[model samples]
Target: MRIRYLLLDVDGVMTDGTLYFDENGREIKGFSIYDGHGIRLLQKARIGVGIISGRSSTVVAWRAKELGIEDVHQGSRDKEAAYEMIKAKHRLQDEAVAFIGDDLIDLTLLRRVGFSIAVASAVDAVKQEVDWVTKKKGGEGAVREVIDFILSAQASHTKTPFS
Candidate 1:
């Protein structure tokens, strides 16, 4: 099956895996423009994108909203539940989904998806389990790199809105 949906883990895959807390006890995160543009390309190619994060942050929510990602599942202690909900919501099968992760919290879902990916700086266990390990580390063009690979594999890169 082709990759119809791409699921992401927030902390490591989209960010540098660093947690920042302000003096006001609020969390902040940095997202990459390259990843954002990649997501737009994927969407233009008629692929869906979503987020499933173990930790909840408004920054993530804002970013997802900005990127037009509707299937946002944050603060999920049971990621399987989120995964199931996404599949059910979209009437998707395991073969139609792809997940990118860098930690153990994302392992079960990653293994279950059709295409599993790990960022270069991911834990050894995660890297070992994923179908592909990116050359770029998380938050440093890894997501974009993965997008290009998947689209290229499916021979759908030309379908994307951009050349």
Candidate 2:
């Protein structure tokens, strides 16, 4: 199936799943420049990107804005509901959506999406459930790898400047 939309999980899929707290009890998350570029590539190819995270963080909002991703849903324990809402909002079919996740909470959406991806550092169960397991770990170019795979599959890169 052709994928029209891509959904990502922030903690484990975009970040290294590490939570850092400052002395003031503020959160700090590290995001990859490669992942940000990959998101831009997807947008250039007309594929929509969105984020659905179980935890709420201001850093997530900042990163999404930096990437120009408007569909951001944070603190969502029920990712499946968010997935359905995104699908409905975009009027996309089940077979037209791809999701990458890393934990047990992401299972339902992973099982339901057309293309299911798991980061290399993901838990065994998650790896076993995905259609593809990224060679690169999360927050370490895993998202870029997935983007290259999709662009290659769709031949979208043929028209991009990178080609």
Error of 2 at 108 (Å): 0.4
lDDT of each: 0.90, 0.90
| Residue-level lDDT tens digits of model 2 in 1-163 | 5678989999988999999999999999999999999999999989999999999999999999989999999999998788888988999888888888999999999999888899999999999988999999999999999998888967864532223
The predictions' CA RMSDs to the true structure, in order, are 3.5, 3.6
Off by over 4 Å in 1: 156-163
Query: How does residue 5 of candidate 2 score in lDDT?
Result: 90
The CA root-mean-square deviation of candidate 1, after full C-alpha superposition on the true structure, stands at 3.5
Number of backbone-clashing residue pairs for each candidate, in the order shown: 0, 0
Give TM-scores for every candidate, taking all chains together and pairing residue i with residue i: 0.93, 0.94
Tens-digit lDDT track of model 1 for 56-75:
99999999999999999999
